[model samples]
Target chain A: MVEVEMNGTTPSVRDELITEIELSFGLLHKAAANFDNRYISRVFRDLGPLRRKLAKNGDALATVIDRLYPHNSASRAYLLEVTGKTDESMDEETKSAVKPEVDLYIHLLVQVYLLDNNRLEELNKFNDKVIYLLGSYNRRSLDFIQAKIWFYISRTKELIDDLHSIRPALLSALRSATLRHDTETAASTITLLLRNYLLCHEVNQAMNLVEKTEFPENAGSSLVARYYYYLARINAIQLDYSSANEYVIAATRKAPQTQLAVGFLQAATKLSIIIELLMGDIPELQLFRKQSDSLEPYFMLTKAVRLGDLKLFEEVLKKYEQAFKKDDNFTLVSRLRQNVIKTGIRIISLSYSKISLKDICIKLLLDSEELAEYIVAKAIRDGVIEASINHEHGYMKSKELLDVYSTKLPQDDFDQRIKFCLSLHNDSVKSMRYPSADNRSDINKHNLAAKEDEMDLLKAIEEGDLDDFMD
Target chain B: MSLQKLTAELYQLYDQEEYEKCQKILTPIKLELIKHNLLLPTVANSDSKDKINDLKIAERILEIGALSSLLSNNYRGFENYVAQLRPFYSNKQIHAKPEKNTDQTKIISLYLLYLLSQGLVSKFHVELELIYNSKQYNVEQDQYLLFPVNLEKHLMEGNYIKIWKVLKNDTNLPCKEYGHFLDTLVNALRFEIAKSLEQTYETIPISNCKGLLYFPQEQSDATFESIIKDDLKMTGWTFKDGSITFKNDDDSHKGNVNPNSINLISNVLSYAERIESIV
Candidate 1:
């Protein structure tokens, strides 16, 4: 290490340099406190002094801090300070002067935090600095470095109520760190934030951010897929299916390459189609189904549960069982199979009006209470089961059949097809004009009522069930 | 030697009705404005046309090699100065007028007039200058509140006498049907302004070619007259005599140019004379 000499013509020069260094550090601190209004701070402090000193002496302040403070808290803080994470200081000249030292400090702090997983308090203490560095750093390589730290700090195992505090700080961290010019950095930051926003159920905020974001045109298929996924899911929740398909198709354009990515994209694409069906945009259902069928059985199984599609729920479960049987290792596949079976049971419970919880439990071979209640709760929360009755029992009364979700038809070209389907079912009653049966045929007499119920459900599925609900 | 001498020379040229000469003498001084990126072309439709004619006069002056006599600075030197000022010009930005109309429209109109005079002034200061980069400022900030009669509030006025005088006494359409024509004009102007501002990102032309308005493909004299009957109040006189006159509130003022003022008419006339001499 090169030793910095203190006796350069004694106290006068040292004192002036020290005063300048102290002033520069003070400005940096003030900037961190009010980074949003950086322009005002620069005007107040007059960035000329720091910039001139930085030009005159390269990292002389860091050297002085080392000579004076050594390895104390103030020294570590000074080291962290050396990183110059926040570039909100008014002088662009000063920023360019001390950028290397700041970059080194940032990389060092990030490495230290990542290595020592026990540094929770240390990470929390310098959380703003980490965010500042992340935002200020120009390198695209640092994307995951900052994100991993954030993910570790915030997503420690499961979410807690206090986790909400980290969310805004994390958002600010990205805001301050991400530059408008760097496409890769901007796209990654947007994707991470969008995922967090979707998980946090702040759909409106996520959508707003996505709308404002300018992503790279040449970003990998995965990024585009995620972009559409976030949009479709939000619009799915908002019940705006036509708008959702616009994004889903955008996602599909980036598909057909990565099967791993296509799994999620296919699921979202199918979900968008189902949403369109629910919103009464039934024409695109065939196209969506073709995409969903190409995905693996397990992928389709989860979607069926989320969509509450009874027919898809059954078909995918059947496919899952066949795949499981062929493997012959029932022990390994048993848990996966059980999850699919639960999803199927939930779908039936959600799709039909008359289907009881008892029937669902028996069909799934699940205990009447725990597994059945879990399915019902998940269905209700996902909006598969709309709350219907005002019964004293909250959960039971809240449950709704799939028919309850058929909202007012879209007033567009899509509405014409829906009208046609409705007409095919309701407008003209089929009449078989024949001589009165001499002794009413036993087949018709035995149970036309049972046949009608089956026929009605089948017809409903054929008319609107064209949705790619499984995936 | 003194700022007053320069103003007097300009005044003399204006008084002689030598407007082109006045404009030429003002050209070197206008370089100061262009140096500060402040020589905005006149925004009035009529004045922009006048600018083209003035430019032709400048070209003719150059061909005669009289420009050097008129301008203290050489043409190459002025060009160099303009080049040096380009970066500063590009960096300049002005704020959007706030949606909330806290600014007084009369004050804004006066400010606009002051800006025009500053552009015309021989010696202008950069620090004191307030630039208007937006075209919408004239319509939204000036026309609504500063104009003698606002279209929106015309019908709602409690001063029935003033309203009736503006209508029946005015030499436009009959005052009874004033509402129909004026309302249409007000709505059309509002939409045109809003549309222009919404469309353009750069400094918008506040006024387009006057020819677009005055000389249409088809002759519609009645339509044109009805549209600007109020504005014509300031510029014209009895149509039969073809004499230019202005409405004077008091008998104290004698002429359209205010002859009683110490230097007002002389100053205007000198500027006019200088402009004519340049041509």
Candidate 2:
């Protein structure tokens, strides 16, 4: 038997084939630029002609393979089978069932497949081919195509630049795209730009753009809600609590009851808790926290204290400790940690005479003796703890430290209120007098002064003072 | 396991003069790492690759180029990449844009600078800086590798060198096409600031720093009392104040949402425009 091996394809032939493929790709790209649904449907219809022409070709698959990968001498076997031209004949039934150009269709299908499967390696190769083909265009045409790509990719910075590159032309294209019910382009372009604006901390530009954009009539509920949700986030980041809350409410109403929207709502609620805390509105903070898993317990604890409900405080604190371990990083979450340390001290010192201030300090692991003393002094000044010279009952007891530190650190309008707390404590207590006093009167005075020294050393209270300098 | 560990291994390969080994390890994961959009500081740089020849490291350095584009917050290199991917991902209506060489250079350079400054590059920043600042390194005369550092240094200086040096270097530098424009920008600013500061130095009082820092012409309801009593109640919220004051409308300034967000946006836009003037 004579063996007849096929010759390998030439480089020039491969180049010619690649050039034709590129021309086809360029035409497809131009068609997509219209973004007209009717036009797109018509184009799909027009492709039927090519499909018919491909069907008439006896060896369509092999012909296409030769055109696409002629240099790959390894694909001969696969090619023959694909094209129904194999000399090792298949059964008539199997041959009839196989379709021409199946491989061509599969190659096209692979683009979507690789993207869906996160097979970026294949996708990147495809990208390189397209870039090589399109990279030779003029400047204006280049900008338009690049803009569309960036818009679809949700790569915001490039999207913004591409949008601005030829503002009049880009904007006109976007407007026409929207008119044609290309909601995907409209939503993706606007959302990506908004996200970039937010990332760069450019809230106003984002807000301005967002507020000006009207939702398309047939816009997906999810898309509408997402847009509003991001707008709300910008508001929240800016500390516009009311506006943030309002935008979230609007989003909830606009969005369908889907998991994505629900997730957005949860994020919005977290923002609300932070805003409420800043506003000195503990009750509202708890109310908002109920919607978010992360902030709920912390807010509930604060709510219990603000309402002066001891039972509620103990119940929530117990659950909180179970949920948040003492060593957990979240236990030290700034806002909640502030509430826990201050409120725990305030309630125990003022209301519960049985637990010593020192006992409360131990509960909180506030072993720093300096902190204990300052907290005690702050409580007395706030009138939460009475400043009495009597050592046995009300005088410098360890159990009472918890009550003294419980109040919300007042800010802005309440700044002077904290200062007032500090000054009052300062006036009532005697300064520590040292250098070895032997006389009984001197020793008593020294003890009084030593109590005052603890107040000066407390870190949290000093933090409250330092707050003045910060803003 | 962790990027820190991977980066450390990469560093080890780098240090052992195993450039190909390091490249093999990194090349597969580079796209995935870049896709995460991690900030440069979080990317660990190992010292291992330093033992290899610089040219060997250069091959692996392209991964940094790809990564910088991927991780750019501004998506600087993304357009080029996306343009390539157009046929695969794009519908019939969309096409890849032909990228301008100059535009590509600026973006690629900017992305690299951002990456290098944030410590994301495979080699240490000091090495890049050394390569950048070398007197023998003339960007126009050299290649793309040398161009980025020169552009950055020239940008920082925003100045013109002596005429002979300028004439010699001009043909090599990309900025020469714009006519040594950065010098004009720097000179103009220098002249303006000098003229104003000179006047202010003799006449203006430096006593009121707070007033100088703030908008002196505008009146604010934020009196010291309101600031102290209403705003600064130190319970972990002063940071919130800066954000809030911009949006607060009720008691702070009822019926009016502060346009502070707009101010910030406008300021950034102006700064970007100012930077554009040099390039």
Candidate 3:
């Protein structure tokens, strides 16, 4: 041990204790790295005595250290690494630099352990510490570090199933990114924030965020895909199948063709199939085979839906119930039964120009003729089939198909596309950066120059210097 | 301040419905308890007498904290406290049970009601499965848990009238907090009933509507009519002296319809022909 003179220049007891803690942490790191359970327990067992020693020395750092490393055993290795340079002789700048790193490391290590053990309560405590530390640090210039911390915090909230808490964390992350002019990370964090809102079934909140937040026109493809995927989910939930289908298609088209993005592509495909089925359109079989075994259940669901086989649909749902439940798509799949019946009715109307309500009841497995008539009438009124229900004669009449391209529907589709583009353009215009308050002086100087030019012109005219003006 | 005093103040604030203040007051005490590893009774800390009492006090604080969060609609806070209470409830070594009326069953019932009101059916089932697998309580005997269980079953089976009866006739809602959720569930059931009725009938007599919607006899026909018109937005309805007629729009559909569905059929037929040719 290096001995120091016992004088006023000697290090304080708190500094001495910090050195001891750092030494202990170094030892703990080796034990943890080697997975030595016995040594790990010994290090944990030693923490209390060390804490007592600091308290006996009348050092306030004991309480600070205790607050920082609440679960000392779990965060021993990280704390040691973080506070390695915490010596009285160290410069203030070095201490400040190391403190943030320590704070970040402690949070990351605690998050790892909490996630590993599923200790959500402890994770929430750690989350509060991170928020408090970030507030105290107020290092807006360290945008990447701030974004990383917020990302981890939001991810932890998600892991604990407290999805509602993710919005504030991500919003702060977006704010940090925007403050540093890091637009890429800002866009990505905004996408993640929107996804959390969608996951929480807060579609209005998600839509509001999208409308209020300024997304760069040149956002990353993956982020754009995610944005569209979430938008599609919101639209699907709101019963706008056509708009949902369009969004999912856009998501699929822009989705990255990487192995890591396969999950996103698969999810987009599933939603697309569901939306198409809901809209009474059959998804191409080729779409289902893209993901192979991962999408097999969806393929079967699509098949059942295409054939309009309600029994087959039920069988498929039962067969894949566990998988669907695990994916949280069981409820969405359950709604397909109604779609199956509607598809069957559409098929019947297409096959026959005229069909009796009694025949429809038998063909569609209806409980009564009145129910069949009601279903057929609703289908006709809904535009699912171009047919008329003759209530008096109890027969349905399907109209002959006109020219396929002869309607104003295509113009309506184009108009919708134009409106969407216009909205996007408007959003970009709103997001455009303008000169802030700092640039106001420069603007004032330019205005002053123009005023001087006007005064010169007035003086020139008043002094009969029109010859100079003409020249 | 002592933890006991702070906890008392927290309860007072919570009771006064100053939830945000309760959160602020509890933060320091909670941090201290956590720092000392006394927030919950763990196996390691169970032998210490002081810690055992501290754990009991901490649990009460957490319970009140959870209630305050629920009352304030701070779901994340409520979830965090409930999650912290889980280890104490589930760990066999720590036999810390909620005292008397502030039972775990009531808190869980409120959580279930929150899930129900949010229409988070999957999460509701997941939580129900977790409780079932934990095997911690006699679920059937607990009137609070049984309310959500029976309500979910009735809702799933489309037994709206039975659900209405449960809301109207069931006097024991476990606590006053459940009354708010009960009203929400009743409204959801009413909406479901209205949707199904709209799908099935173009015209229904006003008196028949009363029984279908479970309108109390004391509620006037005009009240029921306004609820359908204003709340449900069924503007196509006309109420005469004794009957209500729903205007049928020829172009209106009950569910989503693909404008290009005809083209979709033609495309499917073409694809089938191509597949047949290849095979």
In DockQ terms, which candidate is top? 3
Cα deviation of A33, candidate 1, in Å: 31
Higher-scoring candidate on lDDT, 1 or 3: 3
DockQ of all predictions against the true structure, Cα-based: 0.00, 0.02, 0.04
Interface quality of candidate 1 as DockQ: 0.00
| lDDT by residue for model 1 (A13-40), tens | 5467666555544434433453322222
- Ordering by lDDT: 3, 2, 1
lDDT of 2 by residue, A1-471 (tens): 001111234445535443443444443444346332222222233233343333333233344444443333333354444344554433333222211122223333233233333445444455443333323322222332332343323332232333333333334445654565556446645655665555444455676786787655444345556667677666654445577666766666565443424555555454444445433345454455455566666567557656544456567756776443321212122223333344555555566554544565565566444334334443443334332222123234333232322322222235455445555555444342333444456546668764453334332222211100100
| Model 1 spans with C-alpha error above 4 angstroms | A1-128, A132-163, A170-180, A211-222, A252-471, B1-279
TM-score of chain B of 3: 0.76
Candidate 1: tens digits of C-alpha lDDT, residues B1-279: 332354456666655656556556665645543453334422331145455444333223222222222133233443343333322222212223332232223223322222222232211111111112222233434342233223212221111223333433436432221232343343333233222222211121212211212225343444433443454221221122221122323243223223335444554565466446445
The deviation in Å at residue B4 for candidate 2 is 36
lDDT of 2 by residue, B116-194 (tens): 4443432223233222333323334444444545533332221223221433455755542233233433333333222
Q: Candidates' lDDT values, in order? A: 0.40, 0.40, 0.64
Q: What is the DockQ score of candidate 2, to 2 decimals?
A: 0.02
- Residue A196, model 1: Cα distance from true site in angstroms: 2.6
lDDT of 3 by residue, B1-279 (tens): 576677778878887889788877877878878887878776688777776676777777888888887777788898898888876665544454422334677888788888888888756755665554333655666777878877776565344545665677657566777776766777777776665555445566787677667777668888888898887666677899787766655353321233556655665575566456446
10 residues in a row with least lDDT, candidate 3 chain A: A462-471
All candidates: TM-score of chain A: 0.35, 0.36, 0.61
